[model samples]
Structure formats: structure tokens, C-alpha cells
Target: MSRVVLRRCIVRGRIQPARTSDVRAPGPRATAPNSRDGATPRHSASHDNRSRTEVPMVSSSVGGVKSPRFFYGWVIIACVWVANFVTVSINPLVFAFFLDSMSVDLDVKRSTLVWGITIRMISGGLFAPYLGRIVDRHGTRWPGAVAGLVVGLVLIGFAFTSNIWIMFGLFFISGLTGFSIFGGNMLTMVPPASWFVAKRGRALSIATSGQLFGTATFAIAAALLIEAFGWRWAWAIFGIVAIVGVVPPYALLMRRRPEDMGLLPDGATSLPVVEVTSAVASPTPTAPVASATHREEPDFTVAEAWRTPVLWANLAATTLLMVAISPFLLFRNHYWTTLGFSPTLIAIGVALDPFSFAIANIAMGFFAERVPIRFTGVIGGVWRGFGMLPLTLGMTWPGSVVLHNVVWGIGSGTTSVFQTMMIPDYFGRTNQGAIRGSITPIMVTVSALGAPLGGYLLDAGVSYIAFFWGIFLAVTVASASFFFQKPPKHAPAATDPPTRMPTST
Candidate 1:
């Protein structure tokens, strides 16, 4: 018989690798369920398994060993990391240097341009749930690849769009299409899921730092790029960077898991074989809370992931609270200028954005790794609500817009990071793309609603006071995603005691 190169497949959480090397050498305990088996997993990130059978199998290649996703997986993470850095950078970059020129030449109101910004925000934010669902079912490789490709294309397409409607369509496409970040939850969880059991916190925190580093470095560069090139050229250049930068690494380096290569989780032999395999075998969740778990360990199935009362509460809270900020951000110049700060001061304040966001995102990343994921959302609520102090006071105090912007920026930064990170914590890694993507349209709706609402308020001679108050109010209430989330029957506890990944992507 030709020697086959299949890797071990788990049966009821036990990893029984029928290796040609070890198949005949093991003692009786090696073949049995040895509680003392020295190959336990370091950490097991939550996964949805409602439709998955007990065994989690990875098909072997012609060469025999199942391909470890890590060999090529890091490549995807690097690519997405660069692209996201470039894509996200475009927002603040364009606003700082090109907003006035673009607005005037396009013959649109500044608030209209706000539509472009908000459209993307809503698209990305709303679809987060759907994206999570996709990752849960299909695994992470293809979705990340596809989303990177489509985002690159959409951004490139955006450069040539001459019509406002076309711009809207393309930008919206970039935003909505890339809703696959939740699919990357596996990326976030890998540190905890695949590394030292003792160092899960530190590992996850370090990995999360990539987001802030990417955001900050790219954002600052975007400012300079916009200053040098016209906005159109900036778009073209940045789009190219996103596409060219992300696709190759993703194709060449990224993998879905260490198990794909026949190695045990974390490549460690310290854990029992059965425990290690079971930890790696379970699929991540992408559903309502009630259906999220196979049982009580903060893990759940996609079917029950979001259906719990917790989902509804957080859903409402997250959506409303998040919606308030983007419109304001899109029109920051106009809104803040009205408070009568000079251009220099506004410039100074706007420059603070990357720094504030960098700080907040970095902090949240560490928090995600160390803190209870639920508290991240709650923190967002408190931060954002209180951060609006500037908006409320700026009109009365000279140069108060800066203070307001500072507070709001920090709050927005924290809230954004918390929600962005929560998909993995809540839904696990199952069907992540679908779960995240489905919500994209709601963000669109919010953007559509926000633009006109802000405009109407201004046109009706309403004060910024109302606007700031409204923003703060939403933030105050937005903590519900955390407060209201409930676990399925299988979860270890309904409390938020649970906690939890990696790379630039």
C-alpha cells in the first residue's frame, strides 16, 4: 500500500495522529485517553459548532501531512494589515488636506461629503455580524482573501469615479465589502488559542497593538501624502497601496490553523492529546447568544449566538451609539469651525486624531487580551458619553471645540475598537464574514439618517449643544451590548468574567 500522509483528525476532542513514525511506538496510555498526555492546548478560543459534527477534520494534501494554515496564514494577516492601514488612513488624511478642495470641485456641500464618510462607516459596522457567520462555517482563508481583493478593487474603482453617486457607490463598496474583519477574529484569538496558556493575556495584547500601530503610522503618512498630491492622486496612490500591499502576503503566508500542518495546537506537547485536539477541533460561533454554545465555556453555536436578549441589547446599543460619531467625524471641519476656532487651532486639533485613536486602539487591544470583553463595550459607553464635554461646552468657551474634539475622539476611538474586537469574543470565529457583512446595510442607513439630521438641525438654527447632547446620550446608552449579552446553556457562566490574538491584518 502506498503510504498516506494524512494528519491526525480529532474524534470527540481526542487527537489520534496515525503517524508512521509514532503509530507503533506509543505505550498503551498514548493510544488511550491519557489525562497525563503531555500535549494539551494552551487556549481554546470560542467557536460555533451547532452544525458541526463532533470530529473536526482537516483533509490532507497529496504530500500526506495536513497543511498547517500558519505557513501561509501570516501572509494574509500581513496583507490585510497593510491594506487596512492604507484604507483607514484615507479617511482622516483626505479630510485634513483635501476636504475643502474636493467638496468645492465636486460641487457638493461639506455635509454631502459627510455622506461619503458615513456610508463607509455604516457599511463596515453594520455588516460585522454577517462576516462573523461566514468565518464560522467556511473557515478564514478564502473570506480574508476575497475581502482583500474586493476592497482593493473597490478602492481602485473609487479613484476614477467622477460622479458623486458613483463615488458614493464605490466608497460604500470599499466600506461594506471589507466587512470581513470579523472573519479575522481567528487572527485575534490565535494568540490565546494557540500560544502559551500562561501568557494568553500578554500574547493577545501584543498582537492587538498591530491595529493601533497600523492606524497611527498610516494616518500620519496620509496627512503628508494628501498635502503633496491632490486628493484624486492621493486616492489613486493609496488605493494601489491597499491592493498591491495586501494581496500577495495573504496568498502566500497566511493559514487557518496550526493543526492544518499536523502539529498540535501551539506545537506544544505539554497538554494531553485529547484535550489539545478537542480545543482545536471546535468551530467558532456566529449566531445569537442562545444558540452560540455547544455548552457553558463562553463558547456557542452560530445558530444561537445572537438570539439571546443580550444580542438585542448590545445590537441596539452598539448601533445607535456608533452611528452618532461618523457623521460628526465626516463633517468635523464644518461643525468645529462653527465654534469659531482659527484654522491653525483646528489644524492642531485635527492632528491630535491619529494620536488619540492610536492611544485608544492600543489600549483597547490590551484590554481585549486582558479585560473581560464585555467591559470593553461598557467602557466605550462611558468614554464616548463623557467625551462629548467639548461639543457641549465649545460654543460657550473660546476654543472649546478642541477640547470637545479631543474627548470625543478618544471616546470614539475606544468605542470603535471595542466593537471591532467584540465579534470574535461574542460570536467566536464561525461564519464571521457573513455575520459581520449582514450588518453593513444598517450602517449605511444610519449614515443616510445622520447626514440629513445634522444638516436639518443646522438649517433650523439648532445649536451644537443639541448635537453634543445627543451624541453623549447615545454613548451613555450604548453599553447595552455588554450589559445585556446572555450566554447559551453551554456557557460556563452568564457573567462577563470571561476574557480573551494577532498580526497586522
Candidate 2:
């Protein structure tokens, strides 16, 4: 500076790190510019400095080199995945594995225990709407955390209790407290609907895949635990795992939606606006048909969605399928044993369902956006119905046993994904939790009867064939009805323009 030399400087949006030896004194042209007023012109000096530097500025949308490194949506998905894996692994799903031990130790009938499940379903149905509304307004974090903690405490209490009344009370509390599979489903599914638009299907599939894996892992682990330790210790262990695993992740990582993180759905910078054209009939045969375009989707309110046939149809169809599958699933171990299969064979066959299911879920994540979700549902349901037919034929054939488990598991996995995705697809994300919650009571009411009905058949000396055949018929009819299903058209309107509905979620 004392020598009036130019050294290292920031020039043209880049750093020019000049060596000390390379520094040069300003020339006459750099120091001065020809001007009538006898002063250096500001534009001439700036132009001279610019001519000395050659680096170009990198253009960016926000004047930065790059955007943020991660999407918060994936963090939400990972949290949901962990929560679902832990919650599903501990209660209700793994409970079935320990049922026989619980029945023997507590001197309670298996049917009585089955009724406890029905109570769980009933309680869950009753509380679903209120809980869903809570999710809608407040977000899933508080409800998931608090309910998960309560469920864990109840499970730990379940380990020490021998009274059926106490057990019933615990089951009720667990249902209300979000330990049930129903609660896990609600918790895992609702937030993703708000977080993603384009990637919703993939996100749901990935999250639910954890449920499938948990089903397999926990069922096997329960069996091992019951054999090594007692069922009480096993229950206590599961309760501990749930508390340590599920609550913290959901509380720490879950936000209501991408908007809460200052991000758009699917990490998009802008929302997608779809345009549709309505056809108007011509006055003359030769005249060209008039067409009108519109910009809105059928984002129905809870009342409006309930009024639509599409919602009701989907509900009815889903209810029938659940009714068919629930009993078979609850009684699968007993059914397989009655068929004279060895315990090892039975275990292998049972494991196949969740493994196949997990694989199918992963596949659906990639392809769900491409196909019509309704068609996927119908096809999967039909395939599952077909898979159930092997049970109708006496279980003497191992080939049939293997076939049924693998095929039915795959179908069930895909259908479950569609069912979850369809709600947000048919209804907008704004009221998804509540809308699904409103329909849940009816579905669970029908499903609650399934286990009890199966138990009654078993107690009454009805063969597994009779119960399974009845299921096959119900599933067949329900799946068939879906073939005719379509989104209902909006009534002709003056101010609003009619549009074709989107095909997938």
C-alpha cells in the first residue's frame, strides 16, 4: 500500500490470489481517465479492472453455488420406517405368537383372548377419528410420542398381570394409546401424504416394508423367546424394545409436512397445476364439439367424499377383503398345525408371507406411480383370493402350502399399499387423516367379527376348509366388484368445469 501497489484482491466474483512479487504499481491508464472535468471516470476504472480479470461468475438461481444437500422428507420417511418397525414388532402382530402361552399360563380360553383382540379393534375404531383429527391439526409428533410411551407401559404391565379383566383393560388402553397395528398404520401413513406428492407411493411402500419385515422378525423372535424364556419375559422384552426404539425417533424427526421445513412437496420448487378439458355436445352433427378447460381437482371435503360413491365403494371393498383375510391370518398357526405339518415346516411357511410381502412392497414402490392404483388393488385382491384356495383343498400338499403363502403374501403386500395410497389419491391431502379415520370404524367393525367368527367355527367343530371356503367366496366377490369401479363424475355445473380424475396417487 505504501508503494501504491495492487496485491491479491477479489475480482469479478472470484478471488485473484496474486503473489507479493507479482504485485504491480498502477499505470497511468489505471490511475486516470480522460475526462473534460479533469477527474478519473468511475466507469473507465471499473472497465479497466474488469479487463484485467478473466474469471466468470457462476450463475445460480439464488446466487449460490448449490442448493441444500438433503431433503427433509427422507428424514421423515426414515423416522416413520423405524417407528413402524418397532411398534408393529411389539404389540398385536407379535401378540398372536404368544397367545397360546398367555392362554395356558393365565387359565384363559384362546377365544377369550381373541375377544380381547376384538376389543382392541373396537376401541381403535372408536378413537380413530379423534386421533386422526389430532394428527391433522397438531401433527403426528406429540400423539405418536405420548401414545407410544403409554402403549409401552401397558405392555410392561401386561407381563405381570394374570387377570383377564386386567388384560382386557390393557388391550383397551393399548388400542387407545396407539400400540395397535391400526395406530401404527395411521401414524406412519398420514405424515407421508403431506410430505410428498410425486413420491408418495414410494415413500409409503418403503415405510410399510418395515412393517412387513417386523412382522417376520418379531414373530420368529417371539417364538424363540417363549421357548427360551417364558411368555412373560418375552412380553416385557418387547415392551422395553418399543419404548427404547419408537418414541424418540418419531418425536425427534417427524414434522407435519414439508411446508413446515420450508420445502415443497416432493422437494419441488412449485406446485403442479393440471389442466382438463370438458367436452360440450354439438348442436349439429357436422359441427365441431365445443370444449372447456378447468384447473381444479376433486379435492372433496369429508362430507363431500362420503357422499361420493367412489369412497363408499372403496370402503366396502376394503372391508370385505379385510374380513376375509383377518381370520385366516389370526388363526394361521392353528390351521397349519391341524393340517399335520411339522412345526419347522409351519414356521418356514409362515415366514414366507412377510418375506414375500416385503419384496412385493419394494417392487410396488417403484411401479405404483405407473399403473392405475384401482387396477393394482383389484388384481392383488383377486390373486390373494386365488391363493386362499389351496387351504380349501386339504393341507396335505406341501407344494400347495408353499404356493399359498408366497402368492397370498405378495398379493396382500401390494393390496395394502394401494389401500393406503388410495385415500390420499381419491381425497386431497388436506383432510386425508380425518377422511380415513371416518371410514375406519366401519371397516374395523366388520374386521372385528372375523377372529371371533373363526374361533366359533373352530370350537363348533367346523373344519378350516369351511371357514376358508367362505373367505374365498367373499374375497372373490369383492375383488370382482372393483373391476367395475371408477371415479364418479361430478354433476353438470355452470361455474365449475368437469374434469377427468387422476388415475393414481
In order of appearance, the predictions have TM-scores of 0.67, 0.78
lDDT of 2 by residue, 232-254 (tens): 88878878877877789878878
Q: Compute the lDDT for candidate 2.
A: 0.66
Roughly what TM-score does model 2 have, to 2 decimal places?
A: 0.78
In model 2, where do residues sit more than 4 Å from their true spots? Answer: 1-67, 90-93, 179-184, 271-298, 488-505
In order, the Cα lDDT scores of the candidates are 0.49, 0.66
Error of 1 at 171 (Å): 2.4
- Give stretches of model 1 more than 4 Å off: 1-80, 90-97, 118-134, 137-146, 179-228, 263-299, 339-348, 367-371, 395-410, 413-417, 437-448, 484-505
Report how far residue 28 has shifted in candidate 2, in Å: 76
Error of 2 at 390 (Å): 2.5
Q: Give the lowest summed-lDDT range of ten residues in model 2.
A: 287-296
Model 1's alpha-carbon lDDT is 0.49
